[model samples]
Target: MKPVSLLLAVALGTATVVSAGPAVIECWFVEDAGGGRLSKKPSALLLRQSSESPPPRPDLDPERYLKVHDPAGTLLAAFRRYPRDAPAPRCEMSHYVPLPASAIWVSGLTPEQSCPRALDGRWLMVSMSSPVLSLSSLLRPQSEPQPEPALITVATAVLTVLTHTPTPRIRIGQDALLDLSFAYTPPTPKAATSLAPGPPPFGLEWRRQHLGKGHLMLAATPGLSGPMPAAREGAVAFAGWDDDEPLGPWTGNGTFWLPAVQPFQEGTYLATVHLPYLQGQTTLELAVQKPPKVTLTPAPLIWAAPGEAPPELLCLVSHFYPSEGLEVEWELWGGPEGRFQKAEGQRWLSALSHHSDGSVSLSAHLQPPPVTTGQHGARYACRVHHPSLPALGRSAEVTLQVAGLSGPSLEDGVGLFLSAFLLLGLINMLGWAAAYLATSEDSVEKVRHSTFLYFSLLILSPLPNSSPEGGCWLGGQNPDLEFTQTCIKSCHLKHAT
Candidate 1:
C-alpha cells in the first residue's frame, strides 16, 4: 500500500500580557492519516525565523527542539497516539513550548519583544508519514519503477489569543460567580499557508485538544486551600461556554463556592485560566465581617428623683468587624398617653477601639432631659445598627421611674403618725404643767385651764388624715389612733361638762 503524508502548520502569537509582563505562547496539534500504518520517523519541526536562505528544520525532540511539559494531564491524554488498526485513527497533542533564550540570541531577536513576538510569523510544522522502503525496494526488480515520496500539506492554522477579565470583590462565605471572556483575531491568509494538499487539520480532535488546555483555576497566596481546579466538583463548576463564532469572542461562566472565610482568609486571591495561546489571571479580593454584640447600660430600670438631673444612658457595641458604619438609636415610650417616640437628647459616641482579632468596640451615650412626674414608668430603648446585623438591629430596653411623684407610702404614713403622737403628748404635758401652777391657787381654775390648753393644742397641731373629716380630734373618732383617742376622751368629756 502507498503511504500518505500529513503535514500540519501552526502559527503561534502572544495573547494576554499582565502589567507589562512577558507574554506566553502555547500550541496544539491534531493529525489523522486515514488509518494508515503509523511511522516512527521525525514528525515535528519548529522554525524560529524567516531567512533569505532556507531555515533548518529540526525534529520535535524535547531535549533539543521543544521542552514539552503538560502539568494538566488533559493535554497529553487527548493527544496520545492510537493503534494503527483503529478505524479512522486520530491523534492530538498540546504543549507549552518555550523557546530558549540562546535560540533568541542566535536569531539576533531583540530583548524588548517577547518570544512569541520574536517568532510571530514562524511555523510549527508536523509530518506524519510512513518510513521510506529500503529492503522492499531492493527485493523489487531493477526494471520495475518505484513510486516517488509525496510531500503533501494538510491545513494551516493561525495563532489565537486567550484572556481573562478582572473579577469583582467577593464576600466571605458567598457563592462567587465569575464571567470569563476571551477574544482573538481571526485566522488571516497571510498569517499561515499550506505547502501542499491533504486533509483538513482542525476537526473534532482539534477541538478536544483546544478545550483540554482551557481550564480555569484558583489559588491563594497564604494558602487558603489547595490548587482548586474550577471544573472539579464542589469547587468552581462551569455551566457552559458561549462560542457561537469560531473566530469571535467567547465566554465561560462558572460558579465557585468559597469555604467559610476566617479573619486570616481576608485578602486578595488569583483566578487563572489556561488556554492554547495565553495564560490569563486576575485578582479577587475577599471581604470578612463579624456581627456585633450590643448592650445598654443603666439597664432594667433607672430611678430619677423629682428635682435631680436625669442619668446618662449608655449603649456599648462590641466584637464587631469593620470600625465604621455603626449606628445607635434611642427611643422613649410612656408619657401621659403612653406613646412610643424617638428620644431626642444630647448624644455622643466614644472613639472606636480596634482589637488584635480584627474586631471593634465603642460606647454611645445619651443624656436624657430633666425628669418629670409624667415620665414615670417610661421605657428607654437603645437600638444598634451595623452591616452585619439584621435590618432592625439589636436593642436593649430600660424603664425609668421618677421618685417623689407618688404620694407617701405605708411606711411614710406610719412614721408621720408616730411623730404626730409624740408631739401631741409633749403639748399635753406642758398644758398639765400650766394647769398645775394654776391649781395651786384654785382647783376649778386649774381644770378649766387644762381643758382650754388641750383644745388649743389640738387646733394648732398638724395631723394626718385618719378621721372621717380628714383630720384627727381629741376624741375617739379616728379608728387608726384608737389608743390616743381613748386616753384623751376622758379629759375632753370632763372639760366639756
Candidate 2:
C-alpha cells in the first residue's frame, strides 16, 4: 500500500516546498467489525512521524487538518481540527470505503475524550477491500459486481506534513510499498448466548517500520495508478530520530470520565481527549444492574442440660455477585446489653463458593460459649459486599435462643423455699392470736402489757403485712393506741357471735 505521507503532502500543502520541514502525522488503519463497531486495533497499517528536532507546538488551532485524494482524483479521507477554547471541546472525523469483494461494510470510531483542553490531535480512519488481489474476478464475467481497485495498490508516499511555527519546519512523511504478500485468517466464531452488555473497552495503536539504507521500487501491477517515487526516501519519510528532535510516542497519556454522572446508568457515553496530540474518541455503553440480595440462615442452638457443650452456630450469606469484589464478614452479638463483636479464632470458620448462575454463597460456622454468666441469648450477622450495593454491605441477622437449661430451674427452687418459710410464719401467727384471746379476762393494764409483748413478737416475725401495722400500734400515742384497741375489741366480739 502507498505510504500516507504522500497524501499528507497535498493535505498539509507541503508539496510545493523545496525542503519539507518539521511536522507530525500519525495515521491509523481501522477495519469494520460490523454492528456499528470497529476492531479494537487497526489490522493493516500504522504511520507515525519520527520525533526529531523542532519541538511540537504547545498550542493548537481548530483550522489544522489533513485531506487525501485517490489516484482517479476522488476525495478519499479528510481529517479536520476541532475548536477547543472552552474547558472541553468536541471534534469528529470519519472515512467511508465501498469495497464489494471482502463483504466488510462497517464504520469505525476512535476512543474519544470529552475534556480535551490539554492537547491537539486527529484520527484518520481508512477502510478498503481486504484480500486485495482476487484472482477469481479475472475469470468471472463483468455482468456481476466486481471489487473496486485499492486506493493505493503499490507502496508510495501519500502525505507530507510541515510544522508552521518553527523556522525550518520539520517534514513528517511516509512512503510504503506493497510487498504483494497476503496472510488470510479465518473468522472467529461468536457465542450463541450472551448476558447483559457491559462497558466496552476502546484502544488505539500506531507503529513505524525502518527499511534498509537502499531505495525501494514500486511494482508495476496492472489496474494500479499514481505517480511512483524514484527512490525509497522520496516515496516515504525516511527521516529517523535525530538528537535534535524530541523522543517518544506520537500521542501522550490520557484519562476520561463523563461529567456529573454515574457508571451504573445504562446508555452510551462519549469522551473525547487529546494527550499532546489527537488520537481519537471513545464511546462506552454502561449496563444497568440490580444489587445483589443478602440472606442469612443461622444454625439452630439447642440446650438439653446445664453443663452441655456449646453448639455450633452456622451463618449462610446468599445471593451475591461473583465477580471477585465481594467481602463477607461474620459478627456475633449477645447478652441483654447487646454488645456486638467480630467472630474470630479457630472455632470460627468461613468459606465462599461460586454457583453456576454467577452468584456467590458464603457460609460461616462458629461454636458459641456455654451458658455462662452473660452468653444466654445471642445473635449472628452476615455482611455481604458488592459494587452494586448502595451501602458498604447488606446484612442479615439471626438470633440464637437455647432452651431447657438448669439456670432457670435453680432460680425456681430458691423461690419455692422462700414461699414455704412464709407459710410457716403465718401458722405461728395464728397460734399467738388464739393464746391472746384466751388471756383476754386479765386486768386492763395487765392485758395491755401482755398484748404489747405478744404483738411485738409478731412484729419481729417474718409474717407478710404484719410488721408495719404492729410497729405502728406500739409506737402510737395514747389516743391512737386506744382507737386501735377499740377496733380490735369490736372485731373479737363479732368473731365470738
lDDT of 1 at 487: 41
* Candidate 1 residue lDDT tens string, 206-316: 000121243223321110123322332234334334333333223333333444444544444443333222233333444567778878878776888875667899988
Write down the lDDT of every candidate, Cα atoms only.
0.44, 0.34
lDDT of 1 at 349: 91
For model 1, give the 10-residue run with minimal summed lDDT: 132-141
Query: Residue-wise lDDT of candidate 2 within 286-362, one digit each (tens)?
Result: 33223556655444344423345455655565655434566667777875456888854334445667665445566
TM per candidate: 0.35, 0.27
Query: Which ranges of candidate 1 are over 4 A from the true structure?
Result: 1-260, 263-270, 278-285, 336-338, 404-497
- Model 1, global lDDT: 0.44
What are the runs in model 2 whose C-alpha is more than 4 Å off?
1-103, 107-281, 285-293, 298-309, 334-338, 345-356, 402-497
